[model samples]
Target: MRIFDPHIHMTSRTTDDYGRMAAAGVRAVVEPAFWLGQPRTNPGSFTDYFDSLVGWEPFRAAQFGIRHFATIALNPKEANDPRCRPVLELIPRYLDKDSVVAVGEIGYDAMTPEEDEAFSVQLALAVEYELPALVHTPHRDKAQGVKRTLDVVRESGISSGRVVVDHLNEVTVGEVHDTGCWMGFSIYPDTKMSPPRMVEILRAHGLERVLVNSAADWGKSDPLLTRRTGEAMLEAGFSEDDVDRVLWRNPVEFYGQSGRLDLSETADTGPLFEGSSILRGGS
Candidate 1:
């Protein structure tokens, strides 16, 4: 089964993980700009991080035959840091890049005032860039986070169709479903919803604009969760087309709206991009 994970933080993962994902039938992925698993001290840090996403990361994924794309934003967790807030100013430059598919991993983290400001600002960026937004709903008070996230998106002047509210669960899926935006679920081991639960949601809700991802990153997340979800769907009697729609086509339909998703071009047969090559001077 072909796969396209809409929100995995590959920056924290290894090249081995990339090989494993490609071997597992992952043809493409989007690595949203997110907190670096630790506080970033300044905007320069964000600048370099953004450079790597647009430069180094895509080159890395391509070597393993995976099409990589990224989203740019000041993540909610760091929005509260006065020092890190200037990263907002640096976002616009990166949005214009071809590899940047959306403005994302942006939404409430702690639901603080700073997070609110950053979220509102980046939504405008998504509108200006004419790209889709991949929103990360909070891990706690999830229902309220989704509610507030919808309110911000509704007021952002960007159409709900251009937004994907991610990290959704059973309790939060109902509200996100009611909205016209796309629904995203992260299937993980201990943190987010499980594959069986995700299947149940699909059974109860039906798949239209739904996207499922491993969200594999620095945690104990599995990069093969997309394949596992597809397997569960088949075991539960969903046809190949049904599995294909959720794991692959649905993500294409959503992120493709950006006009920057080029999985074909992304799979070019070449050495890594110059100076960004992971295959040089090493074993």
Candidate 2:
């Protein structure tokens, strides 16, 4: 079955992961800007990271025949840092670029006042830029975090149809479901929702506005979990179309609001980016 991982971090992944994902039927992915494990020192650090998201990372994904797109934002964890705040100004320019499909990873880490301001401003940016948004709920106190998130989203004036509240689980799913915003679950190997758990969610919640992703990054995450979740759906007796709606069509409908998702056959990006290949000694 074809898949479109609506949220993943290929920037922290290896080329081998891309090859595996492509072989698993992942033809496209949207990598939202997020915190690196190491704290960034300044806006320039984010500038370089954003550049790579729109530049080097896409080039790398193309090598494995995956079409890559990005979301631009000052991630929630870094929004609290005074030095990284200027990256907000840099985001609008990137949002104007063709590869940027949304403004996101923009919600709460600690749910501090600083995070609140950043979240509101970036949601406003999404509204102004006419793009979709990807909201991240705080890992702790998640139910409350999602509650406050939907509150902020309501105040932001962006339509619920244009936003996705991600990293949701059984406890938090119903909260987002009634709000008319898309619900996103990150299928992880251990820490977050697992494949069988995600299948049960689909069974209970039905398929509309549900997006399943790997959210795989620089952690103990697996990039193939999206594929694994799809397999579990089939084993649970979900029709192929049911699997497609959650794993593919839902994301397409949400991000497609940006008018930037290009699922058109992955373009031929050739073998080299800036005269360098993803190889030692140019292979």
Q: Which prediction has the highest TM-score against the true structure?
A: 2
Candidate 1 residue pairs in backbone clash: none
TM, every model: 0.94, 0.95
The 10-residue segment with the lowest total lDDT in model 1: 267-276
Q: Candidate 2 has which clashing residue pairs, if any?
A: none
lDDT at residue 23 of model 2 (Cα atoms): 74
The weakest ten consecutive residues by lDDT in model 2 span 267-276
lDDT (tens digit, per residue) of candidate 1 on 26-57: 88899999987888999999999999999889
What is candidate 2's lDDT per residue for 1-283, written digit by digit as tens? Answer: 7888999999999877877787778888999999999999998999899999999999888777788999999998999999889888888999998989999989998899999999999999999999999999999989889999999999999999999999999999997999999999999999889999999999999999999999999999999999899999999999998888888888888889999888786532332222235655476
CA-only RMSD, every prediction: 3.1, 3.1
Query: Following a full C-alpha superposition, what root-mean-square deviation does model 1 have from the true structure?
Result: 3.1
The most accurate candidate by lDDT is 2
